[model samples]
Target: MTLPGITPYDGKTLPQSKAVSATNVHEARTALGNRLRELRQLAGQTGKQLAESLSWQPSKVSKIENGKQTPSAEDIKDWTRITNSTSQATALLASLRTLETQHAEWQRILKGGIRPRQNALAELDQKTRLFRVFEATVIPGLLQTSEYARARFAESIRVFKLANDINEAVEARLKRQDIFYRSDKRFHFVLTEAALRFRLCSPEVMLGQLDRLMSLSALPNVKLGIIGFETQYTASPWHGFWLYDDDKVLVETFSAGLNLAQPQEIALYATVFEELASVASYGRSARGIINRVIADLSPDDAEA
Candidate 1:
């Protein structure tokens, strides 16, 4: 598919210049769509005209411009030629290709064995200055208790057949949280209520995990929000993402994670985050939700 030229939809507004590289693939795709569309409209070219010039299907052109499909390198080159914007097209296409490759499935990472990939997580931990996370499924590694983490890690090792260095894997994840304590850095966490109710581990482990989340919420540098299920709006429909300053967005999937480094995509993600944040309860209200759960876990109230 080639990059199409159509006006950006309402959701595709560009983010601030600083966050250009800190968005997800879907966000980048939207940004690219908007830019290509702008270029095409400037050239007074319709989707069909652009497609005819590039010898691509009109539907393909539409998909590219609409952010539904990724354009190949060859497709990008031809598109630039057709639009007579070679210089800008070359650089943009190169970046687009990078984004496309980064979205490869997690199975590929597993092909190289899970250890190396886990090590990469360690490296990322050392570099990121600020972490803004929205989790829908599980407790973030930074907030997960040891018992909960161990259970989750054990499952990962078993699934991936990664029997060696389990401790190293666990340690890498735990160590990543140390950034939360660094004076120069801060963490903003927004979690859906489902994450708390979902039982990734046993009741006792889950309770401890909730307790850990409560403690983290109390930290001065942390801004924690818990979005209730009954909330009216959510930026994301299902799934969540991690924004690391203006550098990148780590969009986690079941099999693998997508690292977004384009500015446009970063802005879209930021927008979504703002939407999700708006529907969330922060400060005392947020803490009260967790506190109620903790109270439910008390000795006499074990049934809950």
Candidate 2:
């Protein structure tokens, strides 16, 4: 799904410069800041005056107005109230929340390390009854083995310079897997064949992960589908996304995580998912593809 100000890219190529860049979030923040500034000026209050009235540091006002800082919901409310612009509070808060959702940078989210992020996801997992996941490259987190998960986390730590909480993060991730036994929840995972071949982790670790996928596929509550290279595609596998029931769709990018809750956005993703799922191989067919990958990894022990 496209974020505000960003143009949707064609599946074949990267978006051109005319398309909104990653700075959309910052630009959105700047626009909101300008609106707040207008409210203050219309109320005849200088930046220092507004800060003094709100009992905030003068720099807080300047940073916010300059889009260097994101104001919390309460901060927006206070600012609007003091400026006698309470009527704008609703719209301003909505903008702030949207910015927060669209600009959840991994660096900021993982500032406290990975475990907290894992815990937060677990909380969301507890609330979701059905998980519809599509992975274009790597295994989905819920279906990942500890070794595979550790490899993924290590890359995150390296890229984002996060704390070395790999052990705690891995434990929390495995804890989330407990939900797989609940029986009340359902999971449908669609993965492209490329997901199996990616060398994100060592061959041995990936073999274990493939074996885990084989076992998980047999669960009554889980449906695993693999889109082999031979399958004719009905939809372009542009990227991976997770659909938590019909409430929201989560898309992960290199820099940020997008949380989309708009009804239209969810509908679009659901439609694309069905198109991809229709072309995926399931049951024995899916297992055959996984087994082939396993054999390729360990040709000497295909029986193993």
Candidate 3:
């Protein structure tokens, strides 16, 4: 019922932060609208005058100031110009961009080829000093072998009817693994036992990926944890999440990806990861669980 990081075991969204207003997209939009209204009033422009001057319908201006619609980037730039509040424009635009990007629909973000998405990840990947990943569906992309990655991308292509740009996308993802070799970075990965049972790839490919996981487990800077199926967890493994140090957390859903940057929101994911990690076994014990999953994929398993 739970996805891992987003849902509780009871299938509810956990209210992680006390300062929800700071991160709520709706609130951000409304605040921007109210601020615009205040600025318009300060400029001594009535709705009709401002709309006429800006070549906008009165209703469009009214809706924007009433928080019924979000302003486009260009609209905000021009709004500041019309209000003569150029000094505060940068900060306002930055907040607006953050709000929009955080709530961006996956369809819109993926309107271009998958390669761009993969490349965008590379931008964030290289700058990350610490990577903490929790997965409940399949192997984390950073830890997946090339064959395993291709299989996953194929499913994506089918779902989105995207161009068969699998080669470039996979290659870009593979390039991100370079971070795995960097001694300056640290990675902590945790996976639920259920993730191992998902057969996203052929048995041979999954086995190979499992082997790569074991090898990565031995890395001095990497810590891999596998929570056994029987283990009693301290907290729910709700949804898959990635924490980039203490600064950001990325939570993906069926519809969109959430970029949680508020300090409190990031801290909440860090806390959930810790709770999950506490129940997960590492070192040789973690490898033992992975080996069992590898064995489960044997031809004999199909017969049984």
Candidate 4:
């Protein structure tokens, strides 16, 4: 998301919002890095001296200085303190605020087309070794069959008045499942019983999706759990979230997707996932819940 420009502590205005695109974030980041280094030099402190004072590894300092990593507000404050230019703290914070609020609006992301977005997800899927997911409403993308996924994409496109990229987007999303066969990766999915009955697809398609879950649950690296309505729970399923390992959490809200990366935010999501997982049924019990949903749709269908 593009943020408005904020005045730095020095009174010179920097349009950090202009730096929000994928191309410019780097340049803006590098600019901040340069300013940080210049401050250190002005303090007559060497790289090693500053690293020692901050009690950080030399590599950590080097990464932020080279724009290989983004520095936290605390890191910026410490850097300014060491330089005795505590005033620079405000300017650095202004830049940091823009850097932190990187919300990619759905319109902007899908404006290019959904196929590209699917390709982007494929890249991230390949890198993630562990995927922890919880969905209370719609079916998680990774678990959706091509038919189910196509229906979903078609509805979304119509709602958003987007381009007709459903065919290519579904093809791209299916490729993401290639990671499913890799023995090196692991997946944990916790879905509420209501998700299976969401009515996003026809009875046949939803049944097929439930069958897919049953089969995927048996995989050695995949742990699929279903939380039944009968299960007691203290927390509300406010939003669906996917934790990509422990590094990040992707939350789907009504307005937009939230990308949470701060350590505290990640920890909070971890706790929520763990708590929800505790109330979920796994293996045969999980399949039973899915089977019941299918049976409710079609009394003769027992194929789950």
TM-score of each: 0.66, 0.76, 0.75, 0.67
> Top TM-score: which candidate number?
2
Cα deviation of 274, candidate 3, in Å: 1.0
Q: Poorest 10 consecutive residues of model 3 by lDDT?
A: 1-10
> Per-residue CA lDDT of candidate 2, range 71-182, in tens?
9999999999999999999999999978997778787889999999999999999999999999999999999999999999999999998889999999999999999999
lDDT agreement with native, every candidate:
0.74, 0.88, 0.82, 0.80
Model 4, 46-126: lDDT tens digits are: 889999999999888888888888798999999999999999899899997776554445775689778998898788788
**TM-score for predicted model 1 compared with the true structure:** 0.66
Report the error of model 1 at residue 201, Å: 0.7
- Counting clashing residue pairs in each candidate, in order, gives 8, 0, 7, 1
Q: Model 3 over residues 1-304: C-alpha lDDT tens digits?
A: 2222332423233444333323455667788899988888999999898888889999989898877788888888888899898887898898888787776767777778778988999899888999999998889999989999999889888887777889998999899888888899999999987888787888889888988998888988899999999999776676898999898888777767777787656766777788889889998899889989888876785567
Off by over 4 Å in 2: 1-94, 299-304
lDDT of 1: 0.74
Note each model's CA RMSD in angstroms: 8.2, 5.8, 5.9, 14.3
Q: Report the number of backbone clashes for model 2.
A: 0
lDDT of 1 by residue, 159-274 (tens): 76755555666676677777777788788889988888887788788888887887888888988999877787634445678888878788766666677766656666676777
Candidate 1: lDDT of 3? 15
Better of 2 and 3 by lDDT: 2
TM-score of 4: 0.67
